[model samples]
Target: MTLPRYAYLGPAGTFTEAALRVMAPEGTAEHLPMVDVPSALGAVRSGEADYAVVAIENSVEGGVTATLDTLAEGEPLVILGEVVLSISFELVARPGTRIEDVARVSAHSHGLNQCRRWIAENLPGALQVPASSNAAAAVALADGSAEFDAALAPPGIGESLGLEVLVSGVSDRASSMTRFVRIGRPGELPEPTGADKTTLVVHLPSDRSGALLQMLEQFSARGVNLSRIESRPRGDRPGEYSFSMDAMGHVAEARVAEALIGLKRTCPVVLFLGSYPAFHGEVTPVEPETTDESFAEATAWVAALRDGRA
Candidate 1:
């Protein structure tokens, strides 16, 4: 069978690139390489692609802005699954290039920040240019063909861009991870893997006191855990904000269904995105270029610590 195409935030080999790979290891996945998260969703909604995978949140950065905005688009583009990948970023450039010669390091803001310590410490004279996507920045370095070469990106991205690894595993925090979601048309939801989470965005009745609190209470009353909640400015009315929530229950679940009904009653609008599987992948980090017995030992140590087996 011909596999479905995935519209992701990439040209190829972004962290988003890795998320798509995890979600559909056997399927024929194609990169949509959108300008932003919104454009990627539009691809899924308009049938330009079968699905859109977006980074919803990061461990340190909280909620992703474009992903939050795109979640407001309602149906035909529902979040079906969430996959979390550990982010161990790397610095890359054409081989034989030195850090002193590197002038501008182009990368997605998040990627650059992950490697800020390395950049700030090593290339004090170089400027950090913010690009939209990690892969996008790598693409710029590849296409620009200028002295403006170095970028902090996923190793997969550097490989795809024909760039060489300059510095490996540069993120300040070792446990850093980004959560991504798979969005697709309603009723066409994928089979529920044990690991999954759903996303929702709501606009409460303007100034309805405790309306937000009430919905959350219902979830709490039912023992549903909320993974994330962020407020976006309700542009229609200045100073007011809308709630974007990422919770641990699916619409298919009875509690989630009840919560939605209660939410609709309290809020003026309740947007239901997809309820797909969450990433069950091992949180293992791979440094660029070098890998050995020590790598396996370190990963095992992290796993042991996570499981309280240490």
Candidate 2:
């Protein structure tokens, strides 16, 4: 089987790695470990990988700016599918080291900050060292490259590097989840699943005061529900902002297509951020089964064996 090439930040273990592990099984993916979020997206835009995934938002830390920035760049890539990963962080140690033995904590800047309240009370004297990647911090400990006794990393990564979990689910909030998206060339639009999502990076026309309202009205008029929307500076552009929006229905759907076309009229310009099959949108009692061809081939071999030895 020719698995889709996947890219994410890596040195071995991290939440992104954990997310990828559950989002797509091994052998079904070829991992690309980028130095940062932007670089991960670059891997897909430059044809380096079949698809790229990056953390966009986290329940604890809020937004991941780097991921949003790259998404706003809007190269030839499009959103193929989204994976919402339940993130559980662990404070790790080399071995036989208790939590009290730790004098300092190292982690990705944001990762450290997200667990700020807990760290403040439990390890008050410990210094905070923010690195580029959380897994890289773990690597530092395993290789004795970092002087700190422990660092925070995704459970999967910490375990992978032969580290012990000193603290579990340290996020101030439990059940925290980070969202990731799989991106590919725009031309390679994912097939319609009837269940789909549309994400748009839009810059409204300055001349209009109710530009955003009007954009929402378009979707509202179509009776389409907006799943998510985020506003970020367009590189801190003077008097300009970029809005990233997600809405129900596939971009190819007549109602969605009409809404997008109407939305364009409200903005000076809008970039389609790849409308693909939506995942993790609705909350229900049962998780919808994935119908991706490879999944079927693996589990429904008889159904997949159509003309073969059946």
Candidate 3:
């Protein structure tokens, strides 16, 4: 049997790698480390890997623009599932280096932002240097190639890489967590678990007033709820924007399907990213009138009326 290949942001020890491990344990699949998120997804698109795992959102940073933009426009891919990991960083430095000796620190942009307050209060004088990833920063520090004296990396990684942990539990928010998705070429979607989420990218028909409301009403009228919705500039036009959303139901559900149909008729571009199992496995509560039975009965009523039997 051939082992599956997974491309993830790496050099090992990144949060994305941890997420991949949650999905596919070590020795079960081949892990390909990419320099960045785009490259990881690209590997999947080019058939270099079976799946790509990348971060989509963080509690403190909100949406990861790179992941959002890359998924919005690309050879179609679908999310297979998601993993949510609590985030905490460790200030790692050369062995015997004290925290006060650190003049510069390196981390990914999101990592820097997440630890901004912590860094301010603790390492007040340290300059922030950006790295491709926190793991990459740790790697640079370990290999003697880093310009920074210390690196903010995932917990346990510093020890694994033979670096000294100067300070642990570094983060502004105690409850910060990152959401990662497993992406693959579109094919059979995961079976509709009652607790599931459907992701999409929608371009509004126009930038006129009430246009945003018009787009949102598709889901509202159908009793579907949105768990997350963020707007990104279309880039083609100044005022134009596209929305990336995670609706709180599976596409296989009647309410979700009808809402999608409504968007298809109104929105100029509606991209269905995928419907996958929600990380927490909490089922979305359906309104009495929006149940599958109700939708089926409504469809039968319409057909009866058309046949002049009602």
Candidate 4:
């Protein structure tokens, strides 16, 4: 049997690689490390890999703009699963590199942002440089290619890469976490787990009063709970925007299907990103199965009567 191929943002020793391990353990599949999120997603899109895992959201940083925009605008891909990991950073440097002697520190933008307070307090005089990823930073520091004396990376990077940990627990909040999603070529969504989330993007037909409200009502009126909702510019018009939403329930459910149909009727485009199992915790059941069955039966009855059937 051939093992599956998985791509992630890395050179290794990055949080993304850690998340990938949780999804595909050692020896289960071949792991291909890409330079960035687009390349990872592109690997899957281009058939170079079976799936790609990348960070979607960070609790402190909110949405990862690169990941969000890529998924929103790129060729279709389906989210297969999600993984959430608590994040922490360590200040690593070449062995015997003193913190006081460190003139600069390097990290991925998000990692730098997450450790902003710690950097400000400890490395006040050090310049900040952004790398493609934490593991990239570690690699540079290890290879002596990075001009910075130290890097903010995952805890064990120091040991794995033969660096030294000058400081630890650098995240602003102890509870910080990042959410990653497994994406693959469009189609073959995960089986409904009773606890799931469906993500989609809605671009409105026109800007009008209560237009946003109208979109929300499509789900709100039907008791479909929304897990996340964000508006991004349509990229062509100055005032026009697109709404990205993650709502509770699988797209296979009647209420979710009805809400999507209503949204399609109101919006110019409704892009179905994919429905997959939820993380963090199991979702509370939204509605009874019988309620959806009853709604489906009534809809069929109405369609039959419209055809003049007794």
lDDT scores of the candidates, listed in order: 0.74, 0.77, 0.95, 0.88
Order of models, best lDDT first: 3, 4, 2, 1
TM-score of each: 0.80, 0.83, 0.98, 0.94
User: Which digits, one per residue and each the tens of the lDDT, describe model 2 over residues 36-146?
Assistant: 888888888888888777887788777788877777775756777788877667899999999999998999977887788889998888999987789899989988899
lDDT of 2 at 233: 79
Worst 10 residues of 3 by lDDT: 233-242
lDDT of 1 by residue, 1-310 (tens): 7568788887677788788888878457766677778888888888898888889888867888887886675444677777788988767888787767788887888777666776788888788888878777777777765446688777777776778888887777789889888887777776644345667888877676786787687666544567678889977779888888866655665555556777777778778776766566322232332224443566689999999999
> RMSD to the native, candidate 3?
0.9
CA lDDT of 238 in candidate 1? 92
Regarding lDDT, does 1 or 2 come out ahead?
Answer: 2
Clashes of each: 8, 0, 0, 0
Off by over 4 Å in 3: none
- Superior candidate under lDDT, 1 versus 3: 3
**What TM-score, to 2 decimals, does candidate 4 have?**
0.94
